[model samples]
Target: MYSQSHFVKALELLILLVVYLAYGSSYRSSSLYLYVTISIWFLVFCWLFAPFVFNPSCFEWHKTVDDWIDWWKWMGNRGGIDLAPEQSWEAWWMSEHEHLKNATIHSLLLEFILSLRFLIYQYGIVYHLHVVHGNKSFMVYALSWLVIAIARVTKGCFIGEREVCHEASNCVPHPQGHRLSCPHRFTVPSVRCF
Candidate 1:
């Protein structure tokens, strides 16, 4: 059963999805450009949800790299010791999986908070351009698409995604200094957003 908070979050997400789709469909964009945007949107989906499907091998690749922050913490024994029993591999993996799932999207909501701004921009800007102002010029279409592309990459790829990845990484050496490893991420189809 879904908790009250989960139900509320799910409702908010549904509303946002409807609004974004409405704005995007308000005016017919150029077919080719529309296709491209749809593709990028799928990529955005893949990027957000990749780690949980696999062991973070793809999106979580950053963890494999040695960072001075992590190195220092491990070496100095600062926050390295967990007196509680080390969790089993199965239990630890399951917990990490669920945490990443929630952070990335709660499979659909909490994680989507990372992309909340982008969603707002999409619905607001698209509606303003396509419906409110009725901007149908090729130049206007191009500019609007550019704005969305930038927002998608910057917000989804960098900002929102990094938050989940950071949370994913923190679980690595927990309850013991020996880092737990998760391997891989993968992706796929789409074609309609506008």
Candidate 2:
């Protein structure tokens, strides 16, 4: 039987193939070509990222993370009140859940790659303009996408970064510090889970 990654990769290829074949010849040289491309690409942002980032079962890191969480709660501490004996808890989890660290890292890596749509999207625009339109607005597009990327970064940290940071908190060390909203429940003092 095929695995989930196989199915997902097949679906991505199938979508690209169908979009390319159906419109490739007709829109090959049109200004609106980017429109069709962006539309399909937007579908990826909507469909793939959220599920991969939030759905714990996909990577099964939930089981590993939850093992510590369950143990923490059963020790008579409140769910949201306290994370007792933080140091020992962190160490024990690292020793026990170390094997799954790679899985969490892989999940985070996939997220980083997929969520790089801003760079990819900007490059697409620049390529389109230079090759197709060929006007001297390179700086304009560059600045435009730069500004957009800035907004994206701000939005990520303030808005959605919390969930993702939390998800990878145990396995990945973030430079943004704890400001990204990774609850102390998931984070330990180590750089990596191991």
Candidate 3:
């Protein structure tokens, strides 16, 4: 039985595929082509990022983070929170939620790869329209789709960096001096290696 997340992921992919097939080849219909491509790109965005937001592991991560939050709340009620407790809580969270950490890393990797694929397809479409068909206006309109694809890829890279920073946050020396860092940095090449 497919879980809800899996079902939704499948549905999004199906919609993307349908859009790509139905309107992607009609380059003469510049408006339709541009709209379909943009919609497809946005769907890809949802495909990649929505999992991070809605995945079961995300809820688990939230729950664990909330525990530290609860601890913070307790400290606040007791008057003045110490950094040590928070650092310890951070450590505990990291140790306990290995699956969440891995899922986040893996999802980011998938997003990057899929974004690249989308961009490549856009590039090909634009190149064909410009070079083969000599359709300047259509080419320009198609460029908009290309631009969005590039932006999405840039966003994916930015998100990847931010996730790296998040995972590394524990290592920075705090007032409490909690030195913790995941040795596994989810760099782009690491995705290829996997």
For model 3, residues 36-63, the per-residue Cα lDDT tens digits are: 6668667666766665676566567677
Lowest-sum lDDT 10-residue window in model 1:
185-194
Q: State the lDDT of candidate 1 residue by residue for 123-163, as single tens digits.
A: 56655644537765667656767977876766554333323
Q: Output the lDDT of residue 37, model 3.
A: 64
User: In candidate 2, what are the lDDT values of residues 86-132, reduced to their tens digit?
Assistant: 43443443444445566787787886787685466456555643443
Per-candidate local distance difference test = 0.48, 0.54, 0.54
Clashing pairs in 2: none
| Candidate 1 Cα RMSD (Å) | 19.4
Model 1 misplacement above 4 A: 1-18, 56-194
Residue 30, candidate 1: how far off, in angstroms? Answer: 2.3
Instruction: Show the colliding residue pairs in model 1.
Output: 57-184, 105-108
The C-alpha RMSD in Å for every predicted model, in order, reads: 19.4, 14.0, 13.9
Segments of candidate 3 deviating more than 4 angstroms: 1-8, 23-111, 124-142, 149-194
* Model 2 root mean square deviation, Cα atoms: 14.0
